[model samples]
Target: MRTNTTPTRKQAPVINFACPSNQSGLTALIARLSAAVAEVEKWAPVEDRLSLEFSKTADKPKVKGGVTKAQQLISDGEPVLDLPATDWFFHTRDAIEEGRAKALAEAAAEDRAAIEQRYVALLADWDAQEAAYNSKKPRGLAHAKRMVSKAHRAWSAAEAAIVDYEPQTLAEAHELLAYAGLDGKRVFFTPGETDLKTIMRNAAAAIALHGLN
Candidate 1:
């Protein structure tokens, strides 16, 4: 019972989301923060090695001469008594946490920049579509039908949501037209309406056409 037909329409991925774009939302925020953590870990080999070896049991582990390793490493030689390994470890950990905060801030700013570019480009493209459709000088019916789709794209960008309407019947089409500021009474012309039938075939034209205007 399979049919050899292919659908001819596709919705943009951004249309599926309610945010400003596919890349801005709570999900994207978490993703960016998670990526920052991975980036930090990927590059902090020295810190990773130190954490694995140190962080453990009872009292602070002391190196030669009653001094901890953190003090010796920070000074590169003699122990810094005032800055013991315990204190130095906490200081270094806090600095790393600060770096993670900065990374997230920078990433959020980048997403804002990219989202602005996407919105600007979307509005420009829709403006061009409206112009192209208007340039065709279509009949009243054709104009209404084409503008329904074109107007929805403009509204979608403004509201950051899909507002498309695909009518399956004449009543539905008229509803869409009304919502889009189009009057449906002016459209006419259907097949075999060349003579007197043309003057009295409003409903025929409605059902015959793609149900617009």
Candidate 2:
């Protein structure tokens, strides 16, 4: 039995290069790299087999006491070791590709969250505007109702003032009422002398009186 006394040296760190300027670009790149790595890894042998073979060859004595066996080993083991390079490259590539994919996925999730937040803010603004419009609707309707009442009163008084008059239709009365309301004038009648209700009643009385004549 040969006593194994070769000191182990740490393996060189693998190099990696995977970065993106933007989130979308990063996601696309990651996907492409991961697929390529997966295809390569599928055909490659397991890592443990490669590691064991490489370890045995690497641990073989470079110098046995005074005799140099490194040259002899290199000539014999070089071809065998060369076959495992493809498998080693595939494993290293897969690790890098998987890491990039994970990073991209995380970034995309964050982007989606940001967009949702913006939509929520916009919806809140629209709701506020709708609430304001609804709040003002009743007040606007009340003001319009008051204006209509005022016009009806003014037209009634005007029609009563005409002593010799042709009877007007309801449609014509409504038109006249609208015009009187729009006409910018303020008239003051004494409470007993002439009220709008009294004027309207008299107008009806005049119509009946004329019919009798």
Candidate 3:
């Protein structure tokens, strides 16, 4: 006669894993970097257009108006209208244009410089944080919880396979459950084995009964 005996599996040892808590900090840093890059892109187009406009009309005066000798006389309450209409155009055009071009160029240059500086700093901080996050191993209760969740998912999959097998007898079902990683030792059911709505109605009835009591 031949006999078959079930083999006992040895218990596996637990491993300690490390979890980094700076994930949120790293996420914030990445968000900052994205915002900084967006700011640079936003400013680039306006600055470029302004710079190009100034460059194209470099010879032309940019600023249009300033205090003229005639305007000054008018401001001084002199009868300027009595004199030939002041040649306002010839006196101020060149000076105003030149002043405006210079001002536009200077402002664009300053803005571009500031954007570059901020972008570089954000890039550096983001890179450092990302590197730190990558280097650390996941640890602690959070890691344990993740592992437990994974195991639960695996068990659920096993249960699904067992259910699909459609064993006719309780023994056959228990055997399939055992094959699918369940020990077939314990069973748990919600009170009254009812659906959610029924459970809720029962809870309301219990509350009302307690009130009457």
- Top-scoring candidate (lDDT): 3
Instruction: Give the local distance difference test score of model 1.
Output: 0.36
lDDT of 3 by residue, 1-213 (tens): 000211111212121222234533223222333333344345455555554554454342222232345322354655654433333322233443454455456676657566555445444544554455434423343444444444333333222222233333344434433433323333311122123233344334544554445
What is candidate 1's lDDT per residue for 1-213, written digit by digit as tens?
A: 001111112333222213324754323322333343343334355444433443331133221112354533335676654644532221233344453455456667657566555445444544554455445432343434334433333323322111222334576445433433323553221112232232224334545676344
Against the reference, the lDDT scores of all candidates come to 0.36, 0.35, 0.37
Ranking of all predicted structures according to TM-score, beginning with the best and ending with the worst = 3, 1, 2
Q: Which ten residues in a row have the lowest lDDT in candidate 2?
A: 1-10
Cα lDDT tens digits for candidate 2, 47-149: 4344455445443211111222232224654553332212111123234345345545666765766655544544454455445544544324444444434
TM-score of each: 0.17, 0.16, 0.23
Deviation in Å, model 2, residue 203 alpha carbon: 48
For candidate 3, the TM-score is 0.23
Q: By summed lDDT, which 10 consecutive residues of candidate 1 come out lowest?
A: 1-10
